[model samples]
Target: MDLTPRTAPEAAAPSTRRRWVPLLVLGLVVAAGGVLVARFLTSAVDYYCNVDEIGERAGCEKGRSLRVQGTVEDGTIERTDGTTSFVISFN
Candidate 1:
């Protein structure tokens, strides 16, 4: 029986294909994960500030979840029924 091994081209073909398969699969997985994370983070919550730019562009209204930046009004801190409230004045 002839015991000579296969030629170099035959041996190299399978090795090259095996090496690239895992790399391609890993790249696809990472891309999918990135898209999922981006969608989740953006949809989780929306933040809006009631400061100068936002307040001027839009208007300030009550019962809106907002971030307000202003100077605390003097003598406006009051405690009523164990609940504290303060008034702020913005320029």
Candidate 2:
């Protein structure tokens, strides 16, 4: 006579994937968050520079927008429509 206990069939057991679905989704969310933070850090640098460093500083290159620390020349700050033009002196 067989003494081994009978076992349930494979179809009766729960799928292994049921336990990993939530973990997989959590991992994806974490990865996406990391990417967003990295992008923000790289693009959010507002370089503070002097007017004399326009061409001498890497962050103050031509056509690049950054914070310039200097005196705005007399009558050089002009505001027309949506644009503002200005010139600064380091002296």
Candidate 3:
């Protein structure tokens, strides 16, 4: 007679992925949030410049954000397509 204890086959245990899924999702969210905040801060930093000076400066090329201060010429304001267009005079 066999004296060894007998055991039946058991179902496979759950995977480790179930435990790590929440942590993985949280990490991704934090990383994405950090990227958004960094972009907002960098893009928000702007320099002041006049329209006349922008043409002469090489660093004032396209894709650069600047605050252009000038006086709009009188009688040059026009409204079209829900947009206001005007000529600014920089002296």
Computed on alpha carbons, the lDDT of every model, listed in order, comes to 0.73, 0.87, 0.86
TM-score per model over all chains:
0.42, 0.69, 0.50
RMSD of each: 6.1, 5.4, 7.7
TM-score of 3: 0.50
Q: Which runs in model 3 stand beyond 4 Å of their true positions? A: 1-37
Among all windows of 10 consecutive residues in model 3, the one with the lowest summed lDDT is 53-62
Ranking by lDDT: 2, 3, 1
Sort by TM-score, best first: what order? 2, 3, 1
The collision pairs in model 3 are none
lDDT of 1 by residue, 1-91 (tens): 9999867654334577789999999999999999999999876644455455454545345544556777778999999999999977767
Candidate 1 lDDT for residue 40: 92
Please give the range of 10 consecutive residues that has the lowest summed lDDT in model 2: 7-16
The residue-by-residue lDDT of candidate 2 on 11-78, one tens digit each, is 76556898789999999999999999999988887888888888897888887668888888898988
* Candidate 1 off by > 4 Å: 1-9, 15-24, 36-65, 79-84
